[model samples]
Target chain A: MKMAEKRPLDDTELDGLFAAARSTGPEPSGDLLARIMGDADAKTAAVTRVSRPEAGRDVVRARPGLLATLLGLIGGWPAAAGLMTATVAGLAIGLATPDTLDDLTGGVLTSVTGYELEDFMPSYGDLLEEG
Target chain B: MALDALTDVSDEALLIAFGNGDAGAARALTLRLTPRVLGFASRMLGGDRAEAEDVAQEAMLRLWKVAGEWRQGEAKVTTWLYRVVSNLCTDRLRKARGVGIDQIPEPEDDAASAETGLQDKARAAALQGALDELPERQRQAVILRHIEGMANPDIAVVMDIGVEAVESLTARGKRALAAKLAGRRVELGYEDG
Candidate 1:
């Protein structure tokens, strides 16, 4: 609701107005409750960085696609999204992976790598000749 | 380690135990928090229950991962959770601006009896619509204050704002909310507090 005139309502008055409005509104239940909570939970899960910079920027600012740059070139910084899709995409890709060790199971790094079972067996020619 | 101890313990305590590789503490904390966090997420995202649940689960997982590093008195566990959830919502909601809520399976029957359950469902649906119209900050403030019954100071801390600012936001937000629902009081069938 738009106020036609500049209303100098006290804080208490404003509180009452809001309370009355909200009271009259419906109470959430059933699926809706599930829905809101689900959103909140998903949000919490995804929040990686807890503290933000006071300067209102993350330590790094992501660069958007050329379109964003073009927009910036033509207009100004206002054209850029607060978060660049490229940067978040890159970060997400980065976080999803960690360093891995070489496959010891498939390679000679295994303890048995230097020796072959076949080679350890006495050769038939040597055995027969010795006999 | 015991159920009683875990139940009585604060989230922070359980987290510390989890850090030390206490499986029981991890289970207890997840079970204790999952439902409430799920509920909060559902409400904040305007009936997107499935997405909300996903968000909650992810948030909980992250919380578990960071349990060891958590410092005492940095923030209340629950408040920290709410703040985290809100930020996630902001990110996803922005992405989902034009996207409709994905279709998800709904249970026809649950604990409630049929007739009253139907009525409750209608009421809940109505409430969700009105809530959707609220500004993000107002909706969050309302949910924390009225639904979660958090103190002003705690809300402020979670919101990353001053006490006075919290008061003003809540007040203005609630007034707008009240104005929005002026005529629906009788339908909701609850006396105004």
Candidate 2:
């Protein structure tokens, strides 16, 4: 089909046409904005979480408990050695005097309850004196 | 206070801030960019409001995804966004079957005097009808150059064409629009020559 003659719009007319079109330009709806912002928030949250290990590490200082603090104060292998030493010493003492542990247990129970122990019970002070 | 701070930041800076988890920056960028995208998409999609909205949102979504990796100095942010909107509108237009312009509702404007506003709407509708009849590239070039008032170089970037090509398309587009609208001048409230 033969095309019609192209009659160019005058600049003034073009301006009027454009002005009318510009005035009629669509505004982004509130629903659309909310949806886009929601997507942004989600993606931002994802990026933040992924990067948290590096940036957030300093902000998140983990507090150790009391036992952990004490253990840390003594430091690494020395704490373990100290615990082993105490355990060995107690075992040696118990083997040397088998009744010592039993006597101490009974004497502590009798003192606390004010219940007299039988003749077999020995006080901590008496054992010390004997040793 | 922070929102205030972000208000003056450049669009690139705002996107970077948004990538770093600033809600204020996202709001600022959204306010700055969405309307332009919506307007461009609407014009490109032949006044299809719903499709234009979808295109705008999708384009913005792509922008957010790439914000952290958006290389500054590579491209202008607005240029990049316009390009995205252009591509998205193209994709939808290719896939869409038949469209009804009558389905498009008139804009709500409570601020203007009723008669003037109605006339304005009629003129706008007439222009859009003329625009829809143009080829896609011509329509885009004309809208960007005329209605959006973008510079030729910027229009070239958005349309992915040479600046000379941009000028040619716009000139032809204007001529066609004028030919189409010549009969409606009186109805559009234009005085007779």
Candidate 3:
């Protein structure tokens, strides 16, 4: 009767069996992981490999080159100021010029007649009106 | 946020962490993962532990390579790992011209041989030999369910098969295992008194 005792398979038994089996496989350690990850990191190095100056890496650039400084200035406030000044100066000159309404209309007449601007200025519209 | 919150996080989310150089997440994914992958490979390769290790390791290396493209919230990481390992195993088996373990080569040696004086080792070896004789899917299914203690749905996910398929494999595998173990029932503690 003792030999015939029934023992049902339980979750714990199954886990025990499996855990025992799991012990058969190799265990990957931290160093193994580091090797794999390091190999991956090497791939990143292949893409962009540059070496900056180690001596002054933390310091501000000692002396910006003349061309580099010029380019920087051109790309910075000086260029913006130059552009605004040019625009404002051009507008002021246009406003102060003694050129009349006829002078402004001359180019339009020249395009319409295929005539040169010098040849068909103030006299041209007057001649046309009379004719 | 805690790791439990990350249970909701998709495989792709874990992969995205890996891509962003999150070494902790990478380590977690590896430790929590490689065993399952190794288990699958080992089953398919018919207990050729070395080849299985290679397959699992290469599969993981490929995962790292594709980390850049892994989209978070897209697919389960384990599924992708399974498919990769499966393909690798298939490729290796195909090239080797022998489906090593499934073809029971004349019942080789004393499966319970004790070159070492360990009864547990002998039993484990005998169990492994029996497992080696099982058909590919049966072995895989059984190893996943009975041996690895994986849930049916997760096994389905890892095997890239439906739940019904998983159920069928497990049932058939268990039946085959029972048949195979009938002779060694005393050893497996399943003897009829």
TM-scores of the candidates, chain A only: 0.20, 0.36, 0.27
Q: Measured against the native two-chain assembly using Cα atoms, what DockQ does each of the candidate structures obtain, in the order listed?
A: 0.01, 0.37, 0.09
Ranked by TM-score, the better of candidates 1 and 3 is 3
- Candidate scoring better on DockQ of 1 and 3: 3
Clashing pairs in model 2, backbone N/Cα/C closer than 3 A = none
Task: Write down the DockQ of candidate 2.
Answer: 0.37
Measured by lDDT, the strongest candidate is 2
lDDT per residue (tens digit) for residues B1-193 in model 1: 6767777888888877766556666667766776667666776787665678677766776676677688987888888888887788778778778765434233223344566455555455545555667888888887777666689999998789998888888777667655665555445444433
Preferred candidate (TM-score higher): 2 or 3: 2
lDDT by residue (tens digit), candidate 3, A88-117: 987876677545643787655334556667
Show model 2 residue runs off by greater than 4 Å.
Answer: A1-9, A53-131, B1-5, B97-113
User: What lDDT does the true structure give each of the candidates?
Assistant: 0.63, 0.82, 0.65
Candidate 1 residue B133 Cα shift, in angstroms, is: 0.3
- TM-score, prediction 3: 0.57
True contacts kept of each: 0.00, 0.71, 0.09
